[model samples]
Target: MPPRSPAEDRAAADSDTAAAGREQTRQRVIEAAIGLLEREGRDAVTTRAVAVAAGVQAPAIYRLFGDKNGLLEAVAEYGFAAFLAAKHVDPDPQDPVEDLKAGWDLAVEFGLANPALYTLMYSEPGNATSAAFTAGMEILMGRIRRLAAGGWLRVDEQLAATLIHATARGAVLTWLSLPEDERNPALLTALRTAMVTAVTNQQPAVRDAGPAGAARALRAALPEQTTLSSAEQQLLREWLDRLAADG
Candidate 1:
């Protein structure tokens, strides 16, 4: 390949600088939208208001995010990124079940800390398809997978995920809705304990030595099962993973 000329190199550098500037402007807009949403509720996050808050023209918001809904989605994504940044996930923990509880607590705390942002991200149903929401789901699934690997799960992986999300969402929204004097810490504790009971087996499959245990054991040994075709093994592994987690 021919080396780039000085003019070409300068053009590339200028393009890079412009791209970085655009991204920085986008971040400023997102931060302004978030502040508006949290301070004055969702209805106050108009493009005009955001432009004034961000010290940018209204057209710039449209150019960067496409529309008002797009801007709100960006704000939601920013909230998710901020929350995830504060969280610490252990890939390998001594006790997967405790790890699960800690993760749940962290999620609930995030929601409580940023009620407006959490409502914007989660109050609606369609957000499941958003990139940020999907990233969060992937993290939740990893925790569920760890439970499965440890033979502590008591429900199908998908169902377990749903249960965990439902419980946490309910706890956060319900707590937020309560009057200050009526808010009880027991509500959170009860929900967390209930989630644990509902999703995890009392005796881990590793210790129970039963069908669930056998299913879990088989799932763990799946990589060594060379008799099955690759596709067949994958299918079997999925079944075993479900069975191992099933109550």
Candidate 2:
């Protein structure tokens, strides 16, 4: 390869500087929006409001996020990233059921602490496509996989994930809807326990002769098995998934 000319080097440096500046501005705006959402609720998070809070012109918000909806999406993505950071992942827990409980509690706590931001993050179905949201889901799925591997999962892995999400979201929304005098900590505890019972077995189901438990264990382990060809493993996974879902 030929060495770069002085002009080319300068152009590249300028591009890098501009990109860094853009990202810094994006961060500033997102933080401002988050502050507004948490303090004054979602209705207070207008583009004009965020731009002023971020110390940038209103046009900058439009340039970076397109519109109010786009800006809210970025704020929701930030909320997901914050929640994901708070999660404590234990890849190989001594008790997957306890691990599940801890994870669910962390999620509910996050939502309760940031009610407005949490509502904005989850109220729109489209927000689920954000990279941060997807990353959070991947972490949840990993936890579910561990449960399946230990024969603790009682439902399909997908169903387990759905139940976990549904319960936590419901808990947060319900708590937020109630008067301060009516809000019960027992409701949260009951929901968490119910979620655990709905999705997991008290004992490792692998000890049983049932196909569901065996299939779940095998499916969890399949990715590590090299005895089968790629095609064979894929086919086996489909069959095992079907059996696992029967639970």
Candidate with the greatest TM-score versus the true structure: 2
Shift in Å, residue 241, candidate 1: 6.5
Please give the distance, in angstroms, between residue 198's alpha carbon in candidate 2 and its true position after superposition. Answer: 0.3
lDDT of 2 by residue, 1-247 (tens): 9999999999999999999999999999999999998899888998888989999999999999999998988889899999989988887888888888999999999999999999999999999998989988998999999998888888888889999999999999999999999999999999999999999988889888678987987898887779999999999999998897787
Give the Cα lDDT of each candidate: 0.86, 0.92
lDDT of 1 by residue, 142-176 (tens): 88877876778777778789999999999999999
Candidate 1 pairs with clashing backbones: none
lDDT of 1 at 159: 79
- Candidate 2: C-alpha lDDT: 0.92
Question: Which parts of model 1 are misplaced by more than 4 Å?
Answer: 220-228, 238-246
The candidate that achieves the highest lDDT relative to the unseen native structure = 2
Residue 232: error of model 1 in Å? 2.4
